[model samples]
Target: MTASPEIQEIAIVTGASTGIGAATARELARQGFHVLAGVRRDVDAEAIRATGIEPLILDITNPEHIQALATRVQGDSQGRAVRALVNNAAIQANVPIEAFALDQWRAMFEVNLFGQVAVTQTLLPALIASRGRIINISSVGGKVAMAAYGPYAATKFAFEAVSDSLRRELSPHGVHVIVIEPGAVRTAMLGRAIATAGELVSAMTPEQRQRYGALVHAVNEQAISSTKSGVPAQAAATVIAKAIAARKPRTRYTVGREAALLTMVRFLPDRVLDRVLAAALRPHYPKLPSVYDA
Candidate 1:
């Protein structure tokens, strides 16, 4: 959906501080749409400010921030129609289900799932009015949960479900709901997730630590390895920009080959898939004594 020459179209991208979100914001701007890049910090806002890109201080979980964004879109001084709303804000931490505190789970969900929902809901009116697209940035974790990835994957799984339901609900209204599932993209997120996992591991009980320590270590190592081999953030952003510009965009798109393959393999039998994942993770396991060795 290319923007009309006469009308100034707008594209909103949340989590524009770094990584895929930041890349997408710039890509969309380059495509001729006025981009509203959402960032949490003043430094990020300053960094992303550029031609065709306006940085907005948006914390999707904050009602005031979301409302302000809605107001800005709805009452555009230039009367620009919002062409797309990219729900790209999210957080992640790889920790065992038992080791992650209940509040930690809630906090993650609040940012990853509920935060996206809030922003989407607030902007739905403008989106429907303009017949705009809703691009949700999900992850490969949404399709398959590995060891120590329970909490992070759960939110993504729920997010995918929500995207499906929202797509069906909004189709008749001329709004497009597209989900972008990306594999390990070389980004700061992975490092932050690894650090969070280490902290969680430190907080675990002696028995829990003994049971899951190697698994957590292996997961972190696997993450690091995958990230080293992952595509750059710009590659994912290009895919997203293509989705935004396609006349008949797909319901879902994958950013990397890893994501494409994993999403397909997810349909395999549960036990078989379990072995596949375990096998994939086994190579990254540390050479230390642990429960998996028993």
Candidate 2:
């Protein structure tokens, strides 16, 4: 059923306490949607409330919190049958695939993949009733592989697949599924990734460290600098809000410089693309033996 023009649009945005999630929630509110900002802690809830959006305490992994969110949305006239569900929560720790702990992988997938699925499942009926949209915030890594980001990107690739299947399955129900691939945004996630890389390096065997040291250091420096230079969180959020609000949003939206450029690289010849990526990341080796600085 087509919703009324005056149906009073409502939205639920996970990971809404900071960065992209917080910005998206505020932008949606500015667009006149009643937004439920899903946050994890009391401080974050308070912070979100300060923006004049209702903040709900939500830890995506916890079933009770999910239940509470479902119950609340199911009951509120102003907020029920939400018109949009923005899945923006994710956790990234840069452990290598070989050295990555099974439990850590499970935990990342729990919040990044399973938790999102559980939340979407709980709200699917309401979303279908309202002919709503589901927006999954993925990453450039979802489309391209990287050395140390396998665990995080694995979840995003899963999310992309989820969005595709959902778009096909829910079209008959008048529900739309959109995936947003953001290349880089200024957020704490990068800091966490860098810290995780450091931790992993410290715990590595000498041979392992020797093999990966220069490359890891280069990546760490790149991540730190990029965190400062990447597009602001608000820019990404604005794009997401646009995708959600438009009547005919694209199935996938790629945001930021890296996302746009790297996606184009996918169409290039394999040998050319390989050379480009390798050159971009390869560490500089001295042409001649270096003398030690006294």
Candidate 3:
């Protein structure tokens, strides 16, 4: 590897505030890398500093920030090349297909898919120079669709394809590209998803609300329980950091039990999978009055 920054390999981890992103940033720092922590909020700078990592104010959706990052990594007179880029920032907004909002869908993609791409492309030259790796943090949702998670799943699926193409294209240049697909972990996003679902269901017509009330409740309960019981974000981050540090990294790293199972489910017959999903996600609707009963 061609080294530029004297303080070990300089690693840039985006969304380094809390959860997996934060854990990964800390792990990288512990591994003796000069870590550049990227977060949208200035308040998070202290959190990164606490981990002994340098903080950069970066909102993936901001074009100016992307440009600045690219310029900085390209180096000035001294010439410093970033050795690794961990695209760990993402957002999950659940929007059931039937009632999906275009604005929310676009917002999710802006952060989860488009934002990652903007940063990656901006820093590609430096990555190529260092023969570094790019780790795109995806999710199991990307591989399989579930009810009420259409928007999030769609973006993740897109991320998977994007990562795959980058891996193929960059392999010859000694740049490794890998993806991390973590299962549900206890995070703020999970709670937000539940709240969003409740809001959506509440706004529906009384009849429609009645139709989906039970189903929505069931989903919310499941989500809350899973958040409580899910793999800790730190565990997932460990797997991700390993992926970045390994000399021969795998193309994909899946964390959590459900993440692994979903990969297998990908091979099941389409009809079988569809039926399974229906059972899991079909909303409960009360039976209409029959003419005989009336």
C-alpha local distance difference test of each model: 0.91, 0.82, 0.79
Record all residue pairs in model 3 with backbone atoms less than 3 Å apart, i.e. clashing.
none
Q: Mark the regions of model 1 whose C-alpha exceeds 4 Å error after superposition.
A: 289-294
Q: Write the per-residue lDDT of candidate 1 for residues 170-233, one digit (tens) a residue.
A: 9999998999999989988998898888888888888888888888889988999989999999
- Per-model clash counts, in order, read 1, 0, 0
Ranking by lDDT: 1, 2, 3
Task: Report the alpha-carbon TM-score of model 1 versus the true structure.
Answer: 0.96
Which 10-residue window in model 3 sums to the lowest lDDT? 285-294
Q: Which digits, one per residue and each the tens of the lDDT, describe model 3 over residues 1-294?
A: 223235466789998888888888888788767778898788888867854488889899999998877766666444545778999888765545666567878888899999999999988988888888999999998899776677888999999999999999999999999999988687766877767776777666665555556555656665676668789888987897788778799999899987898888888998898887667554432245321111
| Shift of residue 189 alpha carbon in model 1, Å | 0.7
In angstroms, the error of model 2 at 272 is 3.6
The all-Cα superposition gives candidate 1 an RMSD in Å to the true structure of 2.1
Question: How far does residue 250 in candidate 2 sit from its true spot (Å)?
Answer: 0.3
Q: What's the lDDT for candidate 1?
A: 0.91
**TM-score preference between candidates 2 and 3, better one:** 2
TM-score of each: 0.96, 0.90, 0.88
lDDT of 3: 0.79
Tens digit per residue, CA lDDT, model 2, 30-149 = 776778899989999888784337999999999999999999888896554588999998888765677677888999999999999999999999999989999999998788766667
